[model samples]
Target: MENSLEFAQQLDRTDPLQSFRKRFYIPERNGKPLIYFCGNSLGLQPQTARLALDQELVIWQQHGVEGWFEGENPWLSIHQRCKKPLAQIAGANPSEVCPMNNLTVNLHLLLTSFYQPTPNRSRILTIGGDFPSDQYALESHIRNRGLNPDETLLEVFPRPNEHTWRTEDILTAIEQHQNSLALVLMSGLHYYTGQVFDMAAIAQKAHEIGVPVGFDLAHAVGNVPLKLHDWGVDFAFWCSYKYLNSGPGGVSGVFIHEKHHGSNLPRLAGWWGYDEARRFEMTKGFVPMPGADGWQLSTPPVLAMAVHEAALAITAEAGMEELRRKSELLTGFLADGLQETATVEIITPPNTAERGCQLSLRIKTGGKTVFNHLTGQGIIGDWREPDCIRLAPVPLYNTFEEVWRVGQAFADFTS
Candidate 1:
């Protein structure tokens, strides 16, 4: 693809999803809209979000205590309503998915049930440089079980000098450690370098040795095509605030394979997860609702779920198949535009299959200066510490021309 405004505009004109750009509020500078390439961090606010949230507020104002049962969309079963779209996004059956607490909280809860250390098999196999919350949660859980973190957590690092991991290295780690591994939990997609791990391969290797496997899909859910159920992932979790565009601190959820729904796998139970038919009975014993709904720790936040429902509907309407097709083209065009810039190094994997919307650039010199200049020119991308700038041209609202302008902004940077 040529790096020219005419070419970029032509691509936008022919894009089937071009009209979708009007559905969200694009951030602006001065009077015009800025180039927004930060959807991997937080998505743009959907126009429907305001109306959805206001509906819940009105329910609260009118019915107060009875809102859970009274409104057109009752709060009592709001979590259930989200199941279908969430399942579609997660690539799991509705029975296996449920929206609940935030990411870290769900991480802790899932680890409690999944990380069962024994005398012979008592270690966890994971990747180095996963999201910090996953690292801390694993460490705390290891310590809680009277084991040392350094001994129980085996992290597979990148080979020698590489930004992204090799699938073979990870597979070997799991195979070598399988004898002593009780759980294998890792990020489906790397946060910093924008690498998509070979999750299907990783899960297959772990399960071959009878080890329980899971993934932190915080970056993978809406950004890529996932078949968590077909791939036999034991469990997975993610946040909706990013590509899902539910809003900041939006509700999080989990996918528990249906096989475990009937089994007595341990879980940290709460009142909200109680068996629905007998919930109001207020019985003493905790009988969990069947399937992934059993993982809920508290009442689902209606306001947050309302916004989530509206945003998720848009994703459902577009469908992941179509979204992924456009995403690859957009990122490929961005990659080609910057391939010749002397000061920039593309650290993210070049293969379309190994990445989604994000492309992390390690600027060789004056990285922050370059980032600031881009900002001044109405190019909005985020700066990671020391030397990287992240630009994610989200397929939902971002356009071909905006990505083209970013390349122009770089060429015009004096440094």
Candidate 2:
């Protein structure tokens, strides 16, 4: 636990998951791998991703349209390859998970089905500062449903100057709005602050008030431990490009609790979601396939699915419990080291359970210069607007040494 290079090297040498770092292609500067602490924005490319895409290309060239039903991993069932891994990652039954669509697309589609408001309870309650897309989707969807955004969209903000929301404050807000609330939509993890919301508690309180609850797990999915099914979450969606290590714009994953599978809940349907047994019939009515797959709105994207499937396989192998264990140690190590640097203000919560691997630092003076200094040293992290540097030490590919070097970079910086 010492803030020393020797200790950091010792931790890396003993990490059981040490070899997993070699599984991805790290970006380079001056022929050396950069300390890439940006998994929150996008993960490094998995070594297997290219080969997976090539296999699909070969199938496309060799079998043409027949590839849908032919080949070892047929295009028709391409989505199935990702199911088992996604299920393991999301803590859901395979039938309840589907890796499809972009994150925002799934958010809108899920909202279309889940955001049914009645006159007595017409409002949607959400965190005040969720990701911009989620904010837009809720506002526009409310308006499209003929509800006034100003009246029907309720938001809960942090108390006064606080950077993160308190669990009690969130629970109180839910109870205050319960009588008028129809749905609770929130991000499992706050993207900007790197705070992990108390999802289980939030879901419980929402349901107790007879409201449906859903989470946008863009930052929480692979970065934290999630038991979506057991937690009684009604629905959720996430992008795979971040912690899942899929290439940019990779297929996103969706989760619908098994309890909703048989219900006649309205969904935006397409031929892909048609009952698998009778898909070719192209019947007049849209009979959705059982479980989360029923929400699909378009045909499978095989090329994207290939890379996604490959990336998820590696995650499944590494396992969330192991990844999270390493993540806590990795993130804590850096946080501890920063205590020696007096000028940096950490906005992310200090509790281990309340955050993943990300540390959102607010530099007191010349923040941008400090960021530039780190970047010049080949220690690459991202700079967020206003004034904050978001650094995520991904356990899958990032080493403890990298985390230590970042601390050293901060220690040596003058600005």
Local accuracy by lDDT, each model: 0.91, 0.92
The number of clashing residue pairs in each candidate reads: 0, 0
Top lDDT: which candidate number?
2
Q: Give the CA lDDT, 0 to 100, for residue 374 in model 1.
A: 90
Q: Tens digits of per-residue lDDT for model 2 on 10-121? A: 9999998999989999999779999999999999999998899899899889999999999677898989989999999999899999999999999999998899999899
- The Cα error of candidate 2 at residue 179, in Å, is 0.8
| CA RMSD, predictions in order | 0.9, 0.9
lDDT of 1 by residue, 1-415 (tens): 8888999999999998888889999988778998989998999999999999898898899899799999677899898889999899889999999999999999999998889999999999999988899999999999999999999999999978788999999999988988899999999988889899888999899999999899999988889999999999999999999999999999998999998999888889999999998999998989999999988878888899999999999988888987898999999999988877999989999999999999999999899899999988888889998899999999989999988888878877743
lDDT of 1 at 101: 93
Error at 46, model 2, angstroms: 0.6
